[model samples]
Target: MTCSACHQGLPADARFCPACGTPAAPGAGRPVPAAPGLPLPEDKRKPVTVLFCDMVGSTALSGALDPETLRTLTLRWFGLMSAEIEARGGTPEKFIGDAVMAVFGVPHVHEDDARRALAAALGIREALKRFNAELERTLGLRIGIRIGVNTGQVVAGSDATARQALVSGETVNVAARLEQNAGPGEILIGPQTLSAAGPTVAVEEAGPLALKGKTDRVPAYRLLALGADDPELLRRFDIAFVGRRTELARLAEETHAARRGTRLLHLAGEAGTGKTRLLREWRTRATGPGHLVHGAGRCRGYGDHGSLAPLADAVRTVLAEAPRSADGHQDDIALGVLAAGLLDDGTPNVPLEEMCAALATVLARTARTCRPVLVLDDWHWAPPPLVRAVELLHIRLGDAPVLLVCAGRPGGAAPPATAIPLRLEGLDRAEAARLAADLIGAPRTPVAARLLERAEGNPLYLEQLLLPADAGTPALPDDELPPTLQALLGARIGALDPAERFVLDIACVVGREFDPAELARLAATAPGTAAPPDGDEPPTVLPVLQRLRRRRLVEPVGTGPRSPYRFAGGLVQEVAYASLSKRTKAERHEQAARLPSVTQAGDAAVGGHLERACRLR
Candidate 1:
């Protein structure tokens, strides 16, 4: 039998052509020999990136130039465009009049096919500029080109006779539409192409476009430069990053170590701490210099299949960003592992040990070529399988130049002893003040200082505290915290043990600061009772308060039995108070209002609580 694409002879029993790698004819035991240069559309469909480039004003150029000159110019255009496409690893599929169509991931699949197509489109546009300049000098005529790129699943194979392989699908149509929509000397790309190319490519929003043959409008982006203009693309808010210089320095050191050997670093912190921000800063500085970096996050909810989701996502990205030429025996083994564990492709299932080994092989191959950094956020939410994958990578690829950086809330199964632990703390008073001022965009009000005091240096908390309210409103009491802040702190409070939560709830109604003796007295009394102080009989709230103290949810104001305990921040008390039922709140308030301790303070204080309890519906 003979191969149709490259005309190489193949075994009669072979299912695919060896030289061209095209599948044998459908229902044929062997591929039949065919004439060269024939078009054959196959039934199999695969993901591919398509590029379409068209010359501007072809009819006018033909009319202005002689027949021979027009033919020469057209030939020159096709030659230069095809060369550019081929240079970027794209196959120049066909020439349709003045347009050139190119395909990537055809004949064979490539990891970065979409990225290569983008590069080729940019190159073709630049080539046209230089080509037109030469034409202007010699033929006194200039021509512009419009290029478009799209990535999607496309039908790929030989037609009925299996003579020639063809690439055609909605991906091709979208690319053509984008080219038509593009202005002269401009390039446009579909959203999927933009996404596959990743954040490295800079682009401006082109808005949704009405493309022909597509029922819905297609969102497009104008292709810009390749490098990112803003390095911190994933930053949450536009607020200035104030602190974390020490963490930044540590990341730099770890990154330097990653160049020589694998390094695993876990960034642990509370929700409002700067774990993600610190990472964004590190990534902004440490991405280049012969390094391939990919990051993915574990989500809050995946139900039953949550364990391997993070690892599966990271593995998919690693495979996608891998170089096309890296395909070898090792690549095949690794891909087989992925097919069984992560990918949806129909490959024989493999054991977990083999799957992890294959995964290591893939990462090791990439690391041998360039430093590979995998950042997994929300590690605490990761399932056992994902955590195990990380452990496997640490053991197998320890000597390889791979760096794994994970960030999440602490207190899950800790990483291996060799892994570096970087715990992020909230900003200091000075740093918090600066961050708060930056957020409020005004001179420091008492409210601002109070917010900084309550927020306790947590960046997310500080931001929520300073969120703008309606203008010209009267000053809010320091205890009246923002609803967003309340909700955030409430979630943290809800996570505490039942006993710990109960103590905090009662302490909230006792005031910003409460004596254990006073709290115990009120706890044993009813709403209508006028309770007397229980003279420091070793308050039962002490044990629970001790736990809250260790959790950083509360703090001791002074020494001795009569000393007061305050919620670590004002927001904590507010959130605790907000969590109670109306009946419980009113009961707690009325009981406190009738206490001898409250009456000794003043009539105003007692009146305040009594009025609140009555107003409670």
Candidate 2:
């Protein structure tokens, strides 16, 4: 058989097309048969944002229109809604009558899935307005929609290559309920969805409502509008900036040096390690000097506008405050042209060299009076053209009072040789405790201690753990990781190739630190282990380990072919382990229990694995 949607050939008993995720004819309820070279479907629990959108008063519209006209209108609505959802990194799961269900953070995951879901919801709202205008002109009638968005845990099962409605759980049900409760043209969002979306979304309290199937009163919000995409808007400025005294001092010194000549500083850290927070604090301090010109821009991981996006933001910010050239009309016009080009799409109409030269000239001119500081946030996502532009600016603006700061996660693009490198680790124990106390609005307590120990000096982690306390909600259980952190770490692990992920899962089961030989042994018998491409031997673990290291997911404990390795962070190990189903974890633990005992500790470890296996089973 073949899929009518995409015309992909399918096996005789296939219920859904593996290539397009399209359902076969009526009553075809079996799982899609795996074709040759295709991987079987995998089911795993994950945090996802679910969106439910339904046409308002659809039954009335159906009564007013002919059957054929209603069919055409329904297809048009689905096309508009699906396009908006997919464009914003959401998967259009399925359509039920006039209702549409979509999901984000599945089949693939991004750290900003919640935000993306909210954006898609807003986009659908706007798209429908235009669509209604068309309908009014052609059919002399308009339609309305009500949307609901919710975020929570769901079990997602689907083929690796297909985008479909694979998630099933309370989260999906809650979204549908929210949609049902909403009024025409209104968008209602659950509390978790609003929190995960951060501070940039403008909303008003819809108060607590008794939702169907939910015992407790579920608090909902009416999404008004999303603020600018500025990364700064998402942060909590009211939270006291803790630690980083030394890093701030270094930044001050860089600002001073820029007075004499140009300087480049690369600030590196892992996710939620306070890179952006530190930059914000430094910018605040530097701006107080009254003799500096500071401008900043952020690079987005999705929908990267162009190579020079960050630089353009910096330029536009500086030009907003910079004084015009005193030379002549021609100089002012040139500066205007340069600013316009940079502010456009960041795709330069001129040659890259010329654009860089023009930027250098603009910055050089601005620096004649006040020191110019340009900050590039999330530099890891910077395209090659942006990197090249920075290199050129470094060379062309020599001896000019320009300071360039690039901040990003570890293992990203390398900075220039002359750029000063600053790596930010977790805060010290004292600082971490202090931060927790401040966020909790009280002195240290047992709960704070547990949070500190688990967070391991990571400021963001501690803050997220304490968020419940601030809201008068009960503290999270000791074993539970925050949902937001799970999404962040899960996205990282999810980005790995199938082989690397398999090895990483095995490593998670072994322990925080494990021998490569032991990992290889576990992986050899691990379910779903793929053979080497050549099929000459069992898959090697070394190459996969190295790739994980490069991605900053794991690191070497010592040196040698058999050197022990560890996950980059404790939370990372937990997230990876959590990704496995209980059965798979039990199976891995059972296999691990049979490894040859090399020492007394090894014997105890084997017993421990057996105990866990028994408990899990």
Candidate 3:
């Protein structure tokens, strides 16, 4: 094949470009140029560990030694791992400022990337051992090196010439995190990779752990012996996940109780406020005998989406774990198990009753076995018929220590009082600042303030305003602001009939506290007893006003002869008022001025004050 880099020719089995010093990017399929002229892309692959290693304490070490000595030291260190890495068929992606990133099973496929990565890690340790020995013997100077390896898939390709195919994924991130957490002469890897490569390297189980951005604490094992196979030691040697500190502690308290007896907990939250985050966190913390079963039904289209969906899902998962004999116990017990507090008719055809029975059966089995976490997300959208079934399951499920977590949308649409609620607001200025700093890679104090103003402490909005590239700097009306929430309010306001709209418009001018007499004059709905052609007395607007309150659109601010009503909520009322015709507005002001002002010697009051404002029109 011809060298894609320098256009020079090369033989089969040649792993890298010779003339241009370009490596053949790993992939399964034949390398086809992108067009008339372009390099190939990395093949589609699953998660794998990626390792990026850098020679640390270099600047200090380089200053003490000459360039020749430094290069000699660097090359010697590189020579040990360079061949070792290539031997395992890992692509040495690049070398930068005393650092290098190597990827395994990327473009080329490997069923066990985790295994290959762990082997490479062991190789690095070996290389360090030899190099450290040589340095002590020859140079008489003791120095340390650090290595970080993480396994996951990356999009590899020539960033420019398309020759350098690099694996870019969170695997790379975990490697960096592993390295950052490393000390001199240490190697760290993720648990999944450790398991995949277990036979090759010896590791010791560290403990239950947590990591940043991860809701759950990860089960971690420390590498004690390379490829140790002592079954007992097998449990110990794996990667330690670090991050969520609080969730782990709470799970420990809950699950420990469940191990002794049946227990239940209702983890509740609005969608995306981290309910799932906490569930995942609990999983890591509640490992072992207390298994977890999960299912979710999102509330999107239906007032009732049928609770049976999640209930069915949860039961199906639990049933999968039961042995064949457990099925016999149902008939063996000689008692018809009521599903979700509802007795099932002996017919097998009713899905609702069958679903209820499934929960009862699962709950009974779990009581005999280990407690498990059952999660259902978005119960609000469950279809009306599904509501009773789902609610029954929740009711039948008692409160002890087993987790019964359900998350849904906030407000009336919120979960029942049985579920604990967490009201999520926006981030404070500091969190926004921290996030912004992380995005920008530096602190922009001024930019942070701007985000606070636009976001108004709404994490979702603040996050949108902060561009991914520069968190502190807002993206503006273009890529930033959430136009949907604004549009939703606007659409709701737009859907209102003219009379309702008129009430809101006049409310803006007369205010919620305006005298009823003045508001009736402004809105022209005060005239009573006007019969329609059908002989229906015209509907009083007070009913319409109350309807608005029921819909949470507005409310009566006072009850008196000069009572006023306020807009149900939000700033849209003002916008509606501003949309009125100038002449209609002027006439309303004319009517308002004739009313007595509240401030004028008890005779002319605020009514007159509002009337004066109306008169000015």
Cα lDDT computed for each candidate against the true fold: 0.68, 0.77, 0.49
Ranking by TM-score: 2, 1, 3
Q: What's the CA error at residue 371 for candidate 1, in Å?
A: 1.7
Off by over 4 Å in 3: 1-293, 302-307, 314-351, 398-401, 410-454, 467-481, 488-617
- Per-residue accuracy of model 3 over 243-308 as CA lDDT, tens digit each: 334545665665675555444444443222344444555665556653454433333221122324
Cα RMSD for candidates in order: 22.1, 7.3, 23.3
Clashes of 3: 66
Q: For residues 1-617, could you state the per-residue lDDT of candidate 2 as single tens digits?
A: 33433223355567775543455675333334332222342577778999999999998999999999999999999999998887766889889899999999876666778889998999999999899999999999999999999998888863444556578999998899999889899999988887777778898878577888999887888999987755557555466888899999989888888877899989998877899889888878874443677788887665527668788888788867876556633346556657567678776768888877777887887876567789999876655567778888888899998999989876545565567899899999988887787777775553446667779888778877776632412356778776688888887777665566778887898888877777776776666644345644444578778889998889999877667898878888988888877788899889877766423477777788988989989
Candidate 1: residue 436 Cα off by (Å): 3.4
Residue pairs with backbone overlap in model 1: 40-159, 41-158, 41-159, 42-157
**Candidate 2, 420: how far from true, in Å?**
3.7
Residue 616 displacement in candidate 2 (angstroms): 3.5
Q: Candidate 1 on 452-505: residue-level lDDT in tens?
A: 777888987776555554321223465665433443454355445445655676
List candidate 1 stretches off by more than 4 Å. Answer: 1-236, 287-292, 302-306, 322-329, 343-349, 411-418, 440-447, 468-483, 526-539, 549-551, 555-564, 593-611, 614-617
> Distance (Å) between predicted and true CA of 389, model 1?
2.8
TM-score of each: 0.53, 0.86, 0.39
Q: Model 2: runs farther than 4 Å from truth?
A: 1-41, 158-160, 163-165, 210-212, 215-217, 228-233, 287-290, 303-307, 323-330, 411-418, 443-449, 469-475, 530-539, 597-608
lDDT for residue 432 in candidate 1, whole number 0-100: 84
